[model samples]
Target: MRYTLFFFLLLLSACLQAQYKINLQINAPKDSIAYLRGVVFDDKNYFPKDTIRIKKNVVILQSKKPIVGGMYYVQLDKSKQRFYFILENNDNLSLEIRGGEIHSNNPRNQVYFQYQKLAKSFEVIDSLYDAEVGRGRKFSYSDKAAFFKVKTAALAAFRKKALPKLNPSEVLHIYFSALNRLDASVPDKKNYAARLAFLKGLDFNTNKLLFIPTYKELVSEYMGYYPTQADSLLKGVDQILSRVNCQSKSYPYVLNYFVQLMRNRNVQNNTEGFVKFVNTYVEKSSCNALSATVKKTLIDDAARLNKVVNLAKSPAISLPDTTGVTQDLHQFAASFDYTLLAFYAPTCDHCQKEVPEMDSTMKLIESRLNLSLGRFYVCNEPGVPQATWRKFISDYKITTNAKHVELPSVSDIRTQYDAFSNPVFFLLNRAGEIVARRISPNTLRKYFAEIQRQRMAQNP
Candidate 1:
């Protein structure tokens, strides 16, 4: 009888561990569609985890499997507005979202939404200030004095009220949100700096929080807030590496985070940071600290990034143009006085807008001088459909005068050019050397104009 009772208890525990309940209610139009997206990594890339069809304006995301604790978003259709929440403890969690407001049983999400409400209120004050300026009226000191007083009081109240009661997980979410706040347009930098300093000193870098999706994000934003110069940036990377245990799983995760960040911005001397990081840490001792795959990726990415810094000879690539005829990039580029080597993707909305602007500007530049600018539009490796690419070209009315090539199978294309996003532009001279890389099309026009003026000055 004792042994049978023990087995029954064990089975009950197993059944309890295997299930989770997540409930969501959104006050939107009936029959609206909403998706529950899981946030992966600090980059906050969302993947659709579950879908809900709103019936009578409510849907329960019931699951028999345990839901992992992380950040998640509830997105409606294709709208820009998204409701974000943190899942903790993963038992009987409930969220009720109405319009832009979120109500939840979770205290962490409640504090987050409260803060959002305060921020929205502040935006109203900001719009009033903007309206004053728009009318060509001189902003009086009295106008902002009231706003500043209220803003200061409200922030102090919120921080004092919300922060002390939070668990480590909840505190980390607030820290992540605060770190990502825009500092460029803030009216009071001194007060903001103090808040940031307090946040930076928090006890966040623990082994327990390492697996949390927002952990590295907090660290990344904290590091980014400082380190305005290249040397400082290099030291910042070293500091992060030294802080985390190399044996821990977070070591490689954090390493990959910084590597990808630098890779995305790897143009001109910006590539120096990534190169130096690899060289410093690529020794057998340090390399052994990382997983085999991560070490290999670091070595391979460094090698490719090293080859294409400003003034480096462009790497040789063979790819078929939109016409299906294979062409050598280096040989073809040699024929033009300058080649605007653009790496883009069809799915990028920003690329969709910018490519046409580039086409228009280049057309205007072509008529001015014998310096014919050839457009080499290289589609980066994303496996976007050929039909989508063709449709994009037709929709944008992209110049048929350019060579359009899709290199989806070429893994080196991303590493070689550091094409982390679409609409990356590289300017190559007749000798197939990169003159300027990752600048806007308007900036490219100014660059060419400067060169033209300099040539006329030198020759005359």
Candidate 2:
């Protein structure tokens, strides 16, 4: 009876052990072994001496030949703090963190350090992910906090002495990984400052060994995050741009940097700065050899910049109505004593909200003088379906006076008028001279009043 009880206890112990085993469901491609990297439980460990009981759900095992690519099962017990990865390869390329010792010692310390740092960072990421799973659409403040916490710890780890001995590519990867993690958190000016400092420390000038692709991505992300610090960012960009002297190889980066600079100037309303910057480029000898498309882009940018600077100084712009027929601005202006030409898009919500109010102002002025208001729904691009355009027009509930037509090109029109955003209104007198321009719904009333006063002064 004692012997029977001992056997029963042994069976019970086996059942308990089975209960602790985490089942992993792995789906791998044909002929490829799964390369497991993340956490796994004790029962799933693929170490040669470890006995792994494959769960029923785990199927479709593939060959481990060539071993570089595939999917693998990883069962991880978060509660028990046990983890393992089961590889299909019986040839012993598999690895596990058994008391901090890796498979080998030649550069194995570096590998182990990287793995441990990554594992810790991933644990934090996993926690954040769990916190975010159920909260839909709404901002997950707690998850954001967790993310920042993990990122801060990861950054601390990266700043340690061990990172310097690593390869240039590895060092860059670490810097950018931290940069990306911080970017997803709340925008902190301090974080941007720290990132810039970290980047400067890397001495990108000497470390051409790091992959160019990775370096460019880091630069782009830095540009995006620190837009307000344009001057500082520009200094970094200038250094990088100087190194990228091959125009054919570096034009894209240069073009994008210039574009970002222009946008930042626009945001700050530093129109004079924008004009000066572009003018310098426009006047450069290299500008002559630039592609037509690039030259045109520069011209468009310059014109827009010029217009913004001249907003309070310049008169209105009058463009022809491009309805069923084409007409020049001069011809169109001669027909009416006062012409209000408006460029708008049907899909634009701002245009939809503002156009009706503008139409009311036009009606008020129509009976007072030989004044007319005309709208041209400029096709944003060529090949926009007629049906789609018509539907957009109908959906907006715009009237017959507001005709639909396609502009030759946005860049051309914008350059000619110095217009930027839509539902733009321009006023012209009988002599085809521009009188005034209005950009907002609230400004329409003021524009009409000023135009009327001007007309009365001229006529009287």
Candidate 3:
């Protein structure tokens, strides 16, 4: 029993001290260097992690620490030639490279190489298939549809047969499974429940799957397919995070993913929902994956979001009118039924375009909606001389002729209104309450037109 315990202790110590080794046999000349790089998020994006120097056609890359598991490749410094492999949890690997092909001792690497070959083979075969169906013939619509059906079936069959034979293990297995589901998804259709289950059951503990290239594409497709409504999308985000182990590295990766996904304005518009997501998940997560600075930034941004986007009434500020006299913003807007709060810069080309477009939009809102509207344009640069502000207003035809103001400093505009970019806009109702935040000046005409159309539909 004592001997058994001693052996167990030795094993544990060995595992703790275990390092990574990659042995390569290449045709490069002696004294040549190679770069060891890796893929983490997107397939096309790679970053260097280490350097390996070759002597006499051989190189051994060694590390004092356990290398993080991911897909890695070795590229020659002076040559376009590269040797790629998918590596994870293995103590050591040996590869013989020739003519852009790798023969690896590690089974995982062998399987991944096979997978790559399969992908390339199918791509070549697809083009050939396209030619076979056409053969210099212009395909009719039915001919095209028939060719697509046959090609898709053949592709699915090839994958189904090839993946099972490759026999990927651990995280690689999960990636392939998710990839199959992704392949099954089409532009107008998907298996939502099955995909949701896959995500819910995914063990992020092995977090190496995060490095798989198309993993993000799968997640993106799932996010876009399931959520038809904005609220549903936000709730879906929370639901996914709720299943994650807060202390696991997956928690922070998934959290930041949703943050990035929501950042695309074309995807979602419920800034309040995203702010609450950040406040809830970011503040409470114990993952320790994010740096202290990043966590603080997220929390600060969430607070700023609530201040700018969640409030019933936007905070008031005083700024100088075009005449250089201080004017109250909310007070100036209170008498009007609705207000167009615009932030622009004197020199910004985009602001120049957006501000002028607002003229027609403002006119449409006032004439069609039959509402009392105020135009309050704020110059983002507070210290800009009144002459610059007046000239910009004149050039942009701010002939909305309501109120044009400027702040005292740029920092105040950035922090107070969260106007980091030029041409931020808001639509506000009377009583100083917000109707919409961060609207495009170009969309305002269509926006109010839709509102009037809805009103007529409901009343008629």
Q: Give per-candidate clash totals.
A: 0, 6, 0
- The collision pairs in model 2 are 34-71, 34-72, 40-83, 40-84, 41-75, 41-84
lDDT of 2 by residue, 195-310 (tens): 55545543333232221233444455445444433354455455555454434333444555555565542223334445555565543536344577876787677677677456
TM-score of each: 0.53, 0.40, 0.66
Instruction: Indicate the TM-score of model 1.
Output: 0.53
Which has the better lDDT: candidate 1, or candidate 3?
3
Model 3: residue 372 alpha-carbon error in angstroms: 9.4
lDDT (C-alpha) at residue 56 in model 2 = 29
Each model's lDDT: 0.66, 0.47, 0.68
**Ten-residue segment with the worst summed lDDT in candidate 2?**
38-47
For residue 109, model 2's alpha carbon misses the true position, in angstroms, by 12
The Cα RMSD in angstroms, rounded to one decimal, for candidate 1 relative to the true structure is 9.4
Model 1 worst lDDT window (10 residues)? 181-190
Best by TM-score: 3
Per-residue lDDT of 460 in model 1: 95
Highest lDDT scorer: 3
**Candidate 1, residues 1-460: lDDT per residue as tens digits?**
6457545644664566635456576787633778888665553544567877765444545545654466677878745467777665445667897776789886677777777678778887778778877785664334455656676567656766666676645534455444333221232223546435634543444543553455665565556544333355666676567667767645666777766655543222345666666778663444466767767787776676666654477777778877899977787788888888888888888898788878887777777766677888888746788889888888988864578888776477677777877888887888888887676765667676777899899999
Residue 93, candidate 2: C-alpha displacement in angstroms: 14
